[model samples]
Target: MDVMVPRVAALPAAMELLDRLHDQHGPLMMHQSGGCCDGSSPMCYPQGEFIVGDREVLLGVLDLRLFTGQVRPDAPEDADGVPVWISAQQFDAWQHTQLVLDVVPGRGAGFSLEGPEGVRFLTRSRVFNESEVRALAQQPVLTGADWDTGARPPAATRPQVVTDVADACAIPGG
Candidate 1:
């Protein structure tokens, strides 16, 4: 069976930053900035610290062990997974791309967790190739609008489908 390609991936430095932050904060989550002051930087927050609103989108989850090169005996099956979110409006703008998280020198001008660490999390991306696009098409995408009231898909249930993306990537509520 072919392993699915992740829609989001992290560079080494970014993963290192995540490890340090995880040690300090216990757990963390990330949200990709749509634009404005932060540009497209990825903001890391304590898990559930930032209220995911109706305008945000759930992009995908990243495995810390895979990216951080670490293993913990106490880690649960899903313990290493970190959720990555983006604004639905932003997802509409970059649906064909893969978000690559990277870290760079200098304090982030925004409130992202790394701002005070002298490094800022930023994004670099490339358009998906035809094959990647085909594989992505088979996967489900969740939009904030469909996740009304900011409710997450129940853990024991299958992901809810907001709408079919069969018509050339039109966002459900766009």
Candidate 2:
């Protein structure tokens, strides 16, 4: 089988933060915001805290080895690493580059779990060269069903919020 390149990747510093967050938060996930205002920054949250919708996408998952001393309550006794996610639309624009999730000391404006730690997560990117782009082109891109039930609207379709199970079911193949 061919190995696929991930749409999102983390640096060691970001992994360290993820390890610390996982120690306290149990498990974690990230969402890359596409709206204005702190939207450009990726927000980290305790798993399932945020309501993922069709507008969002799962860019990739990160496996940050549990380096923190505390074992999360929900983690298996012998759990190895934690998982993280990124938004799909954000990935479309950034597909040609590699994302490096990092942390810097500063207060971030958003509900991201890390905001209270006096630090926030940031993304650093580098463009993919021809070879890397070619390799990435061969990889399968993640869609809504691959990560969650929410189905993104077609590019020509306007997006709407699914307020309840009924609304979610109303979506085509949602």
Worst 10 residues of 2 by lDDT: 153-162
User: Model 2, which residues run further than 4 Å from truth?
Assistant: 66-86, 149-174
lDDT of each: 0.70, 0.61
Off by over 4 Å in 1: 69-76, 144-174
> Model 1: clashing residue pairs?
none
Q: How does residue 111 of candidate 2 score in lDDT?
A: 90
TM, every model: 0.76, 0.71
lDDT of 1 by residue, 20-133 (tens): 888788678899987798777799998888788766777776667765466667767555556789987889898898777777898876788887898888777756779999
Please give the clash total of every predicted structure, in order: 0, 1
lDDT of 2 by residue, 1-174 (tens): 254555566655676777778778867878776667895887888777887654455555565442333444665642423334456656677777766677789988989888888999887665666877888777656555554643321121111112233322233455
Q: Estimate the overall C-alpha local distance difference test score of candidate 2.
A: 0.61
